[model samples]
Target: MQVQPLDIVVVGGGAFGAASALELAERGHHVTVLDRTASPHPDASSTDISKMIRMDYGADVFYHELAEASLDVWEAWNADWPRALYHPEGFLVLSAREAEPGSFEFESERVLRERGYDPQHFDAEHLRSVWPVWNADRYPEGYVSPRGGWAESGAVVARLLKLGRGAGAGFVAGSFASLLEDGSRVSGVRYVAEDKSVRTLKADRVIVATGAWTPVLLPWLSDVLKPVAQPVVHYGVDDASRWQSPVFPPFAADMAGSGWYGFPALDDGRIKLGHHADGCVVDPEHRGTVSEDHLDLARVFLAESLPELADAPVVGTRVCLYSDSFDGDLWIGEDPERSGLIVAAGGSGHGFKFTPMIGKLVADTIERRENPWLHRFAWRSLAEPRQEAARMQH
Candidate 1:
């Protein structure tokens, strides 16, 4: 089935939009990426110092497989890009108690083994010997997957935008206002340009990949999509070498129970930590600062888990917003009611790791291609909200 190249307007130039633009343009479609800023918007979730790039999805084999596929591309990108942004140091999953059935750490290791990957299981003694920073008593058992690590998120987005442009995708700086509709079909988008002038972009298809702003821009999705703000903080350590790789790697500290996870120190000696539990619902336009309660919680967790970092100076704090879906699965596909409107949102806080694969997944959706992974992200009716397996239930 031969299809004609369509003129597509992708709203929001975050990971989803930028990647989709690159893939779509490469496939010969006319793509124009409209974003709030030039590239890597400061407030966008995709614009971060570092994000975990792991294939540990607990018992969810679907995401595990998707992440496995993405990891291959991530490695390829490292080879193709001018400089490597993804650092495959490894990921350590820790548990306070011994690994048991149904636990996130247990399931993740079990799944990895089932999929033919060797994860090194360790007891507290082994962990203490390898990563001395951890409180051995607090984390008695866990495993480390040598294949997982972290990516410089903002840099990855910038690279994607550059590649997309080279592939013939155009970029427009503007704030999305509304969809321009012709009858029941979305024919274009109306946005406020950077110069304060109102403008319109006509397209054969419109992809709304605006992240947390999805429900706000498209009110009909409010029931299913929500904007959630999670707290993230960076601590400055005196000796960064002690916190870096081979000694310390990206880690989840009893994450399923405590919602605490952190990365090894950056070159400048700052360690990043975030909570992956239920966040407060917020309006993207008026998202407030990280709550004092959240900060207090982080302090307590550090005091118990990593005493060395408990008193470290706070370098930065942010309220990271996530576009949460009723179910944690991503939303990607055409609208059932609107003919030309497609949505590529619902990152739900774990989308950045799959950056390498999202574009092709979205492109397949747009072209109505038969992709095995497409069904997991397709638009559907709302249901009881279920967090992704790796996320903590608070």
Candidate 2:
């Protein structure tokens, strides 16, 4: 932990950037964070009403352990933070059929039991008896862990921004135009200021946490880091309490199969659902839009999974973007080609939950400390994107 304070500039004040700035600044480093818009930018992926926070990674023990550790932090944050950002409503995962080898539910149950956690397993009869809202016949097998639930993602990001600013981290509003380099070393950044005026920021080191825009901003990474657009739907209902009730926790129905998962109703009477399958390629410039087919899929999922929600009116939709890597691992650590530059993008789809813990890991990498998780996140060449089977991504 003993290191000289270095002037650092972090691009993108979303979850990753804000957390990094907070951690770095707390370590007595002069940190400046720049973003194209506000801290909880409406366009940013992490700005959301709710996001799942769970330790279920199927057979991947690394993330399970990391998630459990982060859960402890989330519990502390729940007590310390003024607002309710973390929710321990628990997470329920269902499968279309009985447990089979290599299936998401099966593997998750296997791993959880191995770790000595008592996950409640339900059969068709039990599921129907306990959760009458669900069409238990279709999803006859499932499990619910009291350990996992959802997070108020946007509020958490805003809270981190406030903490960073309060801890002496400078904040700037701008679009990343280019990086200021001294020969092969990155010195700072040149960006379009909030007033639309071009400005240059100088720093000893720069960390790029620009999420989906990383590929477009640094084209060399396009082959390694890809940005894709996924669909999420929010439905309007008359009895909000029915949908937002304590019994209705965040659950996935055939997630790795149908890629269907949903959050309980928000305070605004809207129930959110998302598909976690491979999203379509998108350009962040013009941006992606939700198509009729995507909405139709949402309809079909509701009809099959939650019959009561089948006829509910569609309130809103989002073409959410994911920074996917060729191998589904995060892209972090210093760029081998560029000195004084660190790359921390590629959230895939499950990165938001790690906001409470990623900062320390990212800070460790930035400070040149040897971290056990570095090898998986380091820059590498993957011919084709192979999303890990351990995590449920439909």
Candidate 3:
């Protein structure tokens, strides 16, 4: 338990903010979530039709464990809710190489087998038996995990926001104006409301989970927290149901090399394909438009992978913002300079999957609990270069 009850103001009511608010409020803290838009902001990274929910993180055991546990929670959420948000359609990992060293697919299959999860490898002959859409000549080998799929990300955010509010957590929607501080100690924040009226809200502790906007809002941390824009393309398919049938699941094509991954068709018959590359550095505030080069790249990928979608018209596109840290790990701890401030914004694109566990860590951090993950996430500095441990890093 915390030493005393805290008045916590969580900035950015997306995945991190809503989860933190719910956890903190459940732990008896007076929590309020301040979002720039409605709690589930459409522009927010969390507001998507679907996101991959796989327990595969290559050789990164920590994240492997995290996702494995999270999958269970997502299943539990489906059981608890009347309408299911999670889709256990399975995840297909197409590898260009056949179990090569340092390969993402090889590492993921190795780890899953070690952990006693049955992940099946499929060569060309085996691949043709299960996957109807798989290009045998293009992808000689791959693996399938039945426990993985995608989730209704935006709907999940809305459900979590509702849960947090029901647990006595207040939510205020408007853009964040500025920090309310007293000599390096942040007391709260000043925000501009929907009516253009300015209001000052006080808190014992301020947690900034504002995603890619974190660096722009707090300029001092700009070097470490960079806002990168990743391209997302949604295509309207005529036979959407057939695209995601049991034979054709959600998959990544030569994930590490091409960074090409896609989801099954949504209820609206739209299929979303997103790349996991390093992405372009962009200002989060003015980022909505995707470049022509990205669209060209998408067409090229579909031509090579799915010939059927070679000339498919693009229905939607978004330059989704990712709050990337210097290293590819999450940053969730107190600011060294500020007395009552906590920094918890770095998602690095693989964050939304950990929605089940992140809030508990935030709550535990505030209570000063000794958690093993704290060692990796604590405030620190290092010169090591960014490493790609997740299955896809282009």
Q: Best candidate per lDDT, number?
A: 1
Give the C-alpha lDDT of model 3. 0.84
Q: lDDT score of model 2? A: 0.85
In Å, residue 100's CA in model 2 sits off its true spot by 1.2
Please identify model 2 stretches exceeding 4 Å from their true place.
383-389
Lowest summed lDDT across 10 adjacent residues in model 1 is found at: 385-394
lDDT at 216, model 2: 95
Q: All candidates' lDDT scores?
A: 0.89, 0.85, 0.84
lDDT of 2 by residue, 290-352 (tens): 889989888988898789999999999888888888777778888888898898888888888
TM-score of every candidate: 0.97, 0.97, 0.96
Lowest summed lDDT across 10 adjacent residues in model 2 is found at 385-394
| Candidate 1 structure quality by residue, lDDT tens digits, 224-301 | 889999889999998899899988899999887888999999989989999988887999978899788888999999
**In candidate 3, which residue pairs clash?**
none
- On a 0 to 100 scale, what is the lDDT of residue 242 in model 1? 89
Q: Distance (Å) between predicted and true CA of 350, model 2? A: 0.6
Quote the lDDT for 386 in model 2.
52
Q: In terms of TM-score, how similar is model 1 to the real structure? A: 0.97
